[model samples]
Target: MAESNKNGATARLRNYFLAGVLITAPISITFWLTWRVITFIDDRITPIIPPQWNPESYLPFGVPGLGLIVALVALTLIGFLAAGYLGRVTMRIGERIVARVPVIRSVYSWTKQVFETVLSQSSAAFREVVLIEYPRPGCWAVGFITGTTVGEVQRLTAATVYNVFVPATPNPTTGFLLFVPKEDVHHLDLTVEEGIKLVISGGIVVPDQANFEGAEVDAAAKAQVAAQSDRAENVEGNGRKRRRRKQTQEPRSPGFITRLRNYFFAGILVTAPIAITVWLAWEFVAFVDGTVTPYIPAPWNPETYLPFSIPGLGVVIVVLGLIMIGFLTAGFVGRSLVSASERLLARMPVIRSLYSAVKQIFETVLKEQSRAFREVILFEYPRKNCWALGFITGPAEGGIQELTPDDTVNVFLPTTPNPTSGFLLFLPRRETQILSMTVEEGIKMVVSGGIVTPPDREVGDAAEPEESTPAPLAKSG
Candidate 1:
């Protein structure tokens, strides 16, 4: 009886320890990560200040977040300068210099455009969350409305289409672009942040159903039923067809070995996504550390003074360097230097052509006025009865529009699973059907291969036809 009591006490103690860990682990980890980021920024930025100007130099101890404040002030000052006429001229001169460098032009142009688009307040990159039926009529998935289809795509179809971005589970960064019909897409009340959380958590962190005010329960039920019936019919038909081919053949049950193998594979499917995500994050940090640490001067390097090596200091230094360069480039003297460098690069023969082509491509894609990949659409490809997903790149340019007597648009039809590689199609305005779903939903469909579907809604008689553009759905603020 004494031994039993002792064992129970030990078990209770173990449980208490586990409970403490459960409660404290998340909070501890969160603060640790935050501290690391703050420390990295502070270490990189603090050294740039002169000893007399530095707060740490006079203070008894170092202060946290001081470097972050300094960085913010520096950026604000740079922006104030860039808003002036001299800053504008300086920026233009610097751009010209970068444009003349063959290899550096491509990198700088793309990087600049990406920053502008992401940072622009007016740009609608991923604002409106939505739902769309993808792969087939019954299946649905969440999407983000990028913008409306424009140029040749709108003219050829004679209808408006929405550009949808469909992000995949686990990794929402990589996904497909789908052009869905405007009336067909069901707008969701959930915010983009909520949608991203749902996707990253693989539906575990679902948004409240009550928030989906526009969702039609009856329509979703009917669509789900229809989908199940269609799947059942297809399975039944396939079974019958297979039976007809061999009269005496009967389906055999799987052996123990086969069952074991299947279970093992199923286990792998459950674990692979999580494993890959963690591994990729670690590799990215390691790569940044490996590449950036070598460039750091020994005297200024954090590792020189510290007993242990810091992984993210190099990344912090790179960020600070970019900010400093932006600050310097906005000034008058920097503009003169940039102009001189540009002239030197322009004198080079073979490098100029390569630089020009790359610079032009970046300008076209990054320009706020450009409508490339802004809208999504659907059209018959190869032949009738077979539909293909595509993004409206822009109006047919060069000799293509002139060569074709009828109005035509350029559509990029991305391949399934991998959206980066796809066919480019030129079709008439009457041939395509524009969709309302966001590009994000379309991407998820392509990545998931029809497994992740959007919510469904009833298409009433009042629904707009393929030829007509539907009215925009009211979006939540």
Candidate 2:
């Protein structure tokens, strides 16, 4: 009896261990991968930054993401400049200089074209999803309709052809581009987003056909498959008969294994964002600690005396130092010293520009927080019917408003993935639509490229129905 009881307990213990692994393994792996990437980037990028300019120079330890921040600011400044007429002319001249190098020019132009096509919002790349027979007649693949075959390729083909991109499993960014006849391409009843998710998941998570009712795309796909199957039968050359294709008729319901795989993926989906966020937060803390710790006298430093070092102790010290400085600056002596120092720096030829620019940026970001980015608005930009998300800086002041046809407001249109650089426009007040969402939410939406959407405000049912809903565009800015 005792032996049986022990066996049961052992079985229960094994199951509990398995359950614990199922819960914690994903979280652990995600954290490990994120740490690896952060350290990797830090190792490479930290050394590139100059010591005088780098925050790490003042600190005892290395700063993660400092190099990245510098690179970001530099790129954003370049982009902001590039939006102007002079910058375009300069860019052209720079391109011409680069074109002089044979190998380098070829690489530059090719890569530039690829980025422009992929990143440009106006391009119709990956807007439509289709299925095409790849590798052989028996095998099939998911592909995106990039566009029509242009110029030489179109002329060579007898029938209308399309540029279909067949992306590899788990990585949709890399793909094979093929020019297939329009009739040969099978249209799937799947949205481009769903198709991408399918490709990224390697066919584990399938979209339900029932959701898209009365869609003729599936019929077209079915006909195309039937024709291909018949063609395969007719093309048999040897005595051995080719097997009829199954799995082509209809997609089967996901079984137990598929469900378990999907659940595993869901765990990853939950863990990944959390892991990345934690890593970034830790990097920031470490960066601040590194920047502040070195300034502390060895006798006063806790880490110097203590057996175990404390993380974020430097952050606390730095915060206290800032408060002290602020308090001192409130007095006459501190103000006089700051002014005198600034005047001296302004007298220097090279240091003046850098000092002024940095000071201006700090003042704009810190002092003018209440005035800047007060409201989120949408206005027509680039062309009519096309709208852009912009933050309302304020009413157009000075000579700028005098020239406009109507009363205007200054709007700061931020660039996506990087919001530091963008176009500033004086838009007519009536043309812009004010949104109820907060500036923080708007910024999040812009930074995430519409992936992070702010929920709509609740409206009364008594109100009249609107004609159409406004959506944030998938543009670069």
Candidate 3:
């Protein structure tokens, strides 16, 4: 009991620390960045301000923090002005004048496009969350439907669909933009914000499944039938004996030490990759500084001017630095370095084994694989007689397909409550069933482990799934 209390106290302290970070970090960082940007702009534009008439000169306290206030007020006024016709005309005229400047025009135009996209309410830049198969088969991913397909590709394909962006794991801001057929792209019943939460959590923090009324009702109906059947069976005496046998064979939870050890291992799994990457980067930098800096050529030497060290000598150093370490690691020279490093490592057996094992694990996990994009399919998973979540990534490749006779498709039966980890099963298309809910709804059901389902009235309708983009599947379909 005493040990348990000590652990609980430590946990509470950690929780409070995390909570403090969650509440205060954003505001503090936002203010610091805003201050720095304001300072930079003030320094750049300071000379433009007339010396005698400067706002700072006239103020008694030297107009403390004036630049930030000015920037904020100017931005707010510009926003207000842009909302009106006359302001827009004035702004357009100013923009036209600014655009005439050669170097500044490109920067100004790019900034305008970014700002307009972020500020304008009508922009459909990131409107919907979608579940699209990416990277490999047996793995389905969450992506944002940025907008309906446009640009040259759409015109070429004659597609009426949109662009779905599958952001990389742990970083939803960067991912591939796939142009999927409208029919193939399944919209989620999740808000864009909620979908973001799900993706960021990597499927751990899932939306409640109870949100789907239809799925719940269907489950309850099935349960009622199952209960009635069980009652009838129990009356036959065989059921009691079967129950006794099954109860005796039930599995047990892991021992405390086993659970604790697994938890520690999981922590190492998450951090080891990042730690190795940082170590490699540091080693590369140190090696470059040690080996290359001496050969950089003495500043005052006669050959330094290349015909005299050469003009743009600084630029040459920068270029050499960029390529030197990279080239060293790629060819014969790189292999020589690796061999030497290994010899040094071998001198320390314990450290060598630990480093080698960690490096191998990182390499395996980080290596790019071609298996991410597999054939899409529909399947009912996680429950019996009740079809819920599915994945379309179960198709076999050339050699694999030839081995199977039945038209097989790969469907990953994702474990509900956590969709990230699941079983990849080869299922037949004919045996697989279609679902009334959209792809997003299915994911929600899976993430919630069948706790959420479509509303009852719509569940029975195979023809139409009400399409007002479902609330985030993560929130319970």
> Pick by TM-score: which candidate is best?
1
Q: Give the 10-residue window scoring lowest on summed lDDT in candidate 1.
A: 461-470
Q: What's the residue-level lDDT of 17 in candidate 1?
A: 100
User: What is candidate 2's lDDT per residue for 298-347, written digit by digit as tens?
Assistant: 99998997999788888799889999999999999999999999999989
Better of 1 and 2 by lDDT: 1
Give the worst 10-residue stretch by lDDT in candidate 2: 468-477
The order of the candidates by lDDT, greatest first, is: 1, 2, 3
True-vs-predicted CA distance for residue 417, candidate 2, Å = 2.5
What TM-score, to 2 decimals, does candidate 3 have? Answer: 0.35
Question: How many clashes show up per model?
Answer: 30, 0, 33
**TM-scores for all candidates?**
0.46, 0.46, 0.35
Each model's lDDT comes to 0.64, 0.62, 0.52
TM-score of 1: 0.46
lDDT of 3 by residue, 74-167 (tens): 4454444554688668767866786687744543443333333433344445566666444343356776654444322233333454545555
The order of the candidates by TM-score, greatest first, is: 1, 2, 3
